[model samples]
Target: MGVVLAGGAGSRVGGADKGLLPLNGRPLVEHVVARLRPQCDRLLIVANRGLDDYADHAPAVHDETEGHAGPLAGLVAAFGFLACNRQALPRWLLTVPVDCPDPPRDLALRLHAALAADATACCAFARRTGKPQPLFAMYRVDDDPVEWRASARDALHEHGSAWRWHAALEAIGVGFDAPGDAFHNLNTPSDVDEYERAHAAS
Candidate 1:
């Protein structure tokens, strides 16, 4: 299933629901759904509050099971939901952040390609600077559910957060040159303005 991690409170955007934020007159989550729909047979939205808004757009809604637990919480929930629904677990889960409305147009296709080339490792988008964009990657859901739950508990103890998903994955970086600046996110009012200007020009 394709997953959009929309659980954050978006404190950076004046406490606005970033997923519901407008992008080219459509909800940012809609842009995400459009890009990801072609990639999976099912789509899941992982959110904290405002799950109804996401559910309005997605086929399924999986909230952070542990509450305010962060992205890893969302990941764990997605895995659990899938395990309960599908007879066999899927090989991978495609994840993207809610705020990034202009993620790579070919994100899903490229991630699948990367995974096919290297079955042992997962894939993540990387900027030219070589930093992994953790939220915009695909993860191999191979671990035991109990083990993942334990990891989530441990992460909550040490960092007061859920599992460190990026640190756990065997990540292969997918690099881009002249990476689309449109991927710049709407964190604040100024960022929204900048994105609007850039988006208008495109």
Candidate 2:
């Protein structure tokens, strides 16, 4: 399944909901969903607020547990939801932050191939600068359910950073080639400005 992490509080953007933020006249989440729809049989949206607004766009909506635990919380909730519904879980989950509009089109296919290349590997996308984009990654979900949930809880209680999620799973890095820099995310008003300039130029 493909999950869009739209539950963030967007504090970096002065409390604005980055997913709802408009980019080129459409909600950021809309762009993300459109990009990922072709890659998955089902779409699950993980949002903390305004989930109803996206109901028409995403097939289902899920929220994090109380205390604003963050993206890992969303993932855990998604896993539980799938388990409860008895849905056929995909081998890997393609996760993308709602704010990132131009994620690689072949993300799901590439990550699947990359993981298959190595027996013990998770795959994450990286910028040319070599910074790992944790949110834009595929995680192995079929292996150990107990350990995955425990690690998620620990990350929530301790720091709410998904870095632990990366550490728990053996991850490999995939890089985006040049001219695809439009994948830059909008975290603030200035970022929106930059996106506008760059998108308009394209």
Predicted model with the maximum TM-score: 2
lDDT of each: 0.70, 0.75
Cα deviation of 149, candidate 2, in Å: 2.9
Model 1 is weakest, by summed lDDT over 10 consecutive residues, at: 161-170
Error of 2 at 74 (Å): 1.6
Q: Number of clashing residue pairs in every model? A: 0, 1
Candidate 2 global lDDT:
0.75
| TM-score, one value per model | 0.82, 0.87
Deviation in Å, model 1, residue 98 alpha carbon: 0.4
User: For residue 74, what is the lDDT in candidate 1?
Assistant: 72
lDDT of 1 by residue, 1-202 (tens): 6888887768888777788988778888998888778777778898877777888889556664554567766766776677566566666778877877767767767777877888677445444466567667776566454454455456545664322544654467777553565356667867777888876887
Q: Which segments of candidate 2 are over 4 A away from where they belong?
A: 122-127, 143-147, 178-183
**Model 2: clashing residue pairs?**
122-170
lDDT for 137 (candidate 1): 73
